[model samples]
Target: MNFKPIPNKFEYLNWQEIECVAKNKRSTVIWPFGAVEQHGPHLPLATDSIFVDEIISEVFKLFSADIPLKKLPTQYIGFSPEHKGFAGTISLSSNLITSMIKEVGSQLSEMGFKRLILINGHGGQISLLNTAARELRSVAPGMAVFPCFLWSGVNGLSELLTKTEIEDGLHASLAETSLMLALKPELVGDDRPNEGNKVEIPKGWSLEGNAPTAWLTDDFSKSGVIGDSRGANESLGKNLKELLINHWSELIMNLMQSDWPNNS
Candidate 1:
């Protein structure tokens, strides 16, 4: 096969297409950040990437009318420091993630792009991401870089959180499993997860509760799962995607019109 790159729009845009976008549009690039960490036996290690891909696609679809944004291939390996005990977990160092984002943003800035956005799907790397965003703005102040998490601004997850108990409702729990089921059913391996060698956290333990504790996944859950995945279904996942699309569409529309400091 004569490969000429993944010839398409967004992630695979050719230089010529990029030039066109640069000249005619308030150009932005969306990078999907994820992790290659364990997500119980039911979900694949690449689950985060799959979720992010959908997020990137939906953002472009919903917000294209407001601004033209190109999607980049998902950064498949992220900072998963908390998951080090897992066999397949591939975590990057904070310095590396931070430096990589800045370097990429600087290059994009040189390419005449005005904005760079990272739509991260993994919560394990939030600290690194926060640092990356700050460093990008400080080092390349001329380019507007926004680091956003897929789960942070979802209104649809509100009720889900209340019912599912978000404190432990993360990881390979109901919400994440439901999303995986909706997006890629074939890869749902076996939704019936059995607790592995993990030591379960306290019944009422909360990740967000005001507890002065420092622990990782192995210290808490027996399997990689933290919340109940008993009720995960396609409908729940579909609803989340819809709400996320709406939320991101509105967010990008505002970002596109924001009084960006670097906008000329």
Candidate 2:
């Protein structure tokens, strides 16, 4: 907001200050997109939002000294039609989410912010987000709209998150639980027996990665957990948080003023 990029909270700044910064095209805006959906029995429904919020906070803290980046308020509800059967899961239509993202991006771009990044935590809406990003390409013309998952953007995430978990896991899995353990210990309740321990994931039932197909959470899991959370620990969570922060801080700082990569 101050444009000084030091000891300043962007969210606290007034519209005049924000406009001044935006006019300069000197800062990047990061919007965290997540969902208010069920995260099994142990984790809060706001798991995705909370995780992204913490990651964005740390990324900013890690980058504040070196870069001009503004953190926008998070979008707490997202596309989660797959989790419909689960109680308390508020799923916005894919169309709604994409349209909203496009609107936000266009508004920010018109304000003269040359770069807009969507740091998404929820996986269900990723495809739609890509569409939103592409839509902004036309609407915003010269602005760079990037939609990405924090873990996927990390350098060595495959080493940290196994292919099995990344592929088969959907909710309340090892990765999400471990992250919650690190960031919000109190919110992570006891790992009830069989939670995330369903031996058979079944055919046509998966959330992310190279899967044969996708299915609803209630189609297979009774506990709403797709993998074992027993193995999660605070240490792993801490390590992951540090790794993510370091990786994003470095990558984002270097790319602040550079052109977007050739890859989509």
Candidate 3:
């Protein structure tokens, strides 16, 4: 059961069709930003992409079936290269990813889709997305570019997870592993690694590494895992998914109703 919905129309859709659908249906054009990063030994390299697509599909289905929210088509843009050191990790430079997103947002704005939401599945692309949003706003002032980091977007759900030492929740952790098991159980392996070694964090050190300095994903985890993935379960994934959908839906609706800054 492949989860992609846009299918063949990904690269060939014309502005007319996109505009028509968005305007008539009040649909919000969604662009899922994912990375081809390693997910430990159990999960696949495409875990982030797969999980993101599944979550969006589930939310779209819920909207189409029950909620009156307009259904929007989503496209996947894989731009992962930071995990290249690890097996099966493919990444793109920050410049390329940022440029691609800006181009997409600009085109969508031209198509009359003022509301563009970036559904980010990978943490590596967070700053890039922010940069792209700012640039897009500069070009298309009327357009509303909202980049939703799905993990951070889910409010209060992180506190529910048992693991507290997991910083940034990189690679495969309780959150991601649980999401995979829930969304695509067939892909997860049963082997569990013993937990004893933890990522050494210097005294008063933060994700930014040195004082007010930024760090990459590789600087965070050695095995590419932040939190404890040994206790991941399907129940937690489902709960997290529900929470994210509700939260994002509310935010999107609010954005739709609000006024767009002339230089936004």
Candidate 4:
């Protein structure tokens, strides 16, 4: 049987073609997760979803067609309780998210797939996805599960952004705005808000760090922007896009060439 590399998307293949790839000992599937949540007035509600989807698609394009890698459809709604009060925000329960991961993972294991990579785009669901990945691994022990954040472990961020932007720019901020400009400038709104950076916690505490608080978007940001976007531009967005594509492509290529947990 002539088997395609399973590039672009997994869902596009027929069941027989999918089964062929699944039966390959080194085959891997990536499932991207994103959120339909608030990203301030300057960005679309599907910012997270769009970023993850587009970035992964670009990563897929970098691989040789001979590689046995395929991406599942992007899960567009994620656990986003912090953005509950904002318009256009859709947050799923933690239980529901975990259950979805397990059910899909179990099926993949049954089909003889070797790996499931959850590439998540939203920061709010990071812990939840980690928990879900472990639970999926527990049930589908034969399948390796990797829950990864889209923005984590990427290089050159500090070189492009300030310490303040790195730490405080949590949401629809400079990085996000600039990235959106590079990807889909039509979806970007005209407003570039500079709010929510002043909600001070005690020294040594942060919105998300050691001694983090259970904070909601409404608790600090009125404009639904958590950092300054005044300095964002398409040039920075292009740089960020390049960084993401190059990073993920290298990581995934390494994964495809090795057995990892199953390697002796």
Candidate 5:
């Protein structure tokens, strides 16, 4: 049986039906943005991409079921591999990732997709994605491309999370570990240890400091974890997932209706 939902037409539909749906529906496309990154010893390397895909799949189902909304014009998954370092991490350069997103956005705009939602999974790609969104907006004035981080946009879920000593959630932390367990329990490891070290970049070092700056996971933490993952559990993961989906759904609806300023 063909499991592919959006791309495969025969099992779910045909090209003609897809075209008709696109023409009749409000033209919006959902892009699942993901990264090939290391997730420690226990988890699979494609953890980030896999999780993002799963989230997008669920969101598609929700839209189809509850909203019964017209099918979106287009939906696709894109990947960048710029984080390749810790054994399984694969990454594209920041420039390449930005350009790819811009091109995709441009193509979508040309296809009359006025609204594009980028469902991003990796924390490291946020800056590049932000830049890409801005460029896309400039290139396509009437098009609106909104980029959202799945882990960050969830409602008050962050406040509910147990705090760790680290400033920001690191490579793999309670939140991510919990998410993995919730999404892909088989991939989570039982023997891996958690890292609770504080983020200590060199003095005056900032994520926005300057170009040519470079650092490795070893420079930050010993176990490649930036926060505590010890307390993460399946229940928390489920709660977080629900919170994210609900919050994101609301946000997407708002964005679809909001007006884009001419000068912005």
Candidate 6:
């Protein structure tokens, strides 16, 4: 079938155009990963998916036409065992996720693509994706995969949110709710319950850090919220959207402009 090139969309191009673009050693493909999981009572099950899809689309829009970057469709379902306690949460097996990444990366490598950037929105799958990336590199030496979390390396979060929110707001919290309010306010529920903040642990131990615990959503939160969402508003969400878009745009632009992995 004949097809028209739709800017930076990988799937929009016809097979011939795809092959031509893939032949470029500087060509980069972005695959956004997110989860079909619970986000407390106030948010939709596809919260993670929606956020990453919107953020990546905005980031791509900011890039110039000369950038050799194209995006694949978003991987909506992800590894989310931590949220399995809540209804409507679908958790994929770790092996399945790793194998899927390997298979996809292998095909991209075979197509002569040089770089694969997996921008993941779900925090639960970070290490799994990292493992998949490393394994993909081993199996397919022609292409490099960079697994990135949505919130990582983004600046200006401290200016808009409190330290407690940054640390303990793991799910369905102020930042997420606010960002959702900015991106998809109609999907956000009005009941912003402030729960899951009173649990106490040892001094050195933390929920997530160098020392971490594999806790379930039902453990500390009956409502499934892991932080306070009292002051969540649309304004905060707007600021968050800008920060995310700017951070990812700069990062991907830098990647497109360099030949870092192949430089050595």
Indicate the TM-score of model 6.
0.96
Candidate 6 Cα errors over 4 Å, as ranges: 1-5
Between candidates 2 and 4, name the one with more favorable TM-score.
4
Q: Model 3 misses residue 140 by how many Å?
A: 1.7
Runs off by more than 4 Å, candidate 2: 1-10, 192-207, 257-264
**Candidate 2 vs candidate 3: which has greater lDDT?**
2
What ordering of candidates by TM-score runs from best to worst?
6, 4, 2, 1, 3, 5
Q: For every model shown, what is its TM-score relative to the native structure? A: 0.86, 0.87, 0.79, 0.96, 0.78, 0.96
Please give, for residues 34-140, the per-residue lDDT of candidate 2 as tens digits.
89999898999999999888887887765544355688888898888888898999998877777787888888877877788888898777788888899878888
How do the residues 113-179 of candidate 3 rate in per-residue lDDT, one tens digit apiece? 6567788887767777888899988987766777777777567685667445344455587777887
User: Taking the candidates one at a time, how many backbone clashes does each contain?
Assistant: 1, 1, 4, 0, 8, 0
> What is candidate 4's lDDT per residue for 56-85, written digit by digit as tens?
999888787757788899999999989999
The candidate, 2 or 6, that scores higher on lDDT is 6
Worst 10 residues of 6 by lDDT: 255-264
Model 5's alpha-carbon lDDT is: 0.63
lDDT, residue 117, candidate 5: 73
Number of the candidate with higher TM-score, 1 or 5: 1
lDDT of 1 by residue, 90-131 (tens): 988888898899898888777777788888889877667878
Q: Poorest 10 consecutive residues of model 1 by lDDT?
A: 192-201
Query: Model-by-model lDDT, in order?
Result: 0.75, 0.77, 0.65, 0.91, 0.63, 0.91
Enumerate residue pairs that collide in model 5: 9-13, 81-90, 81-91, 81-92, 82-91, 82-92, 83-91, 84-89
Candidate 4 global lDDT:
0.91
Candidate 6 lDDT at 255 equals 87
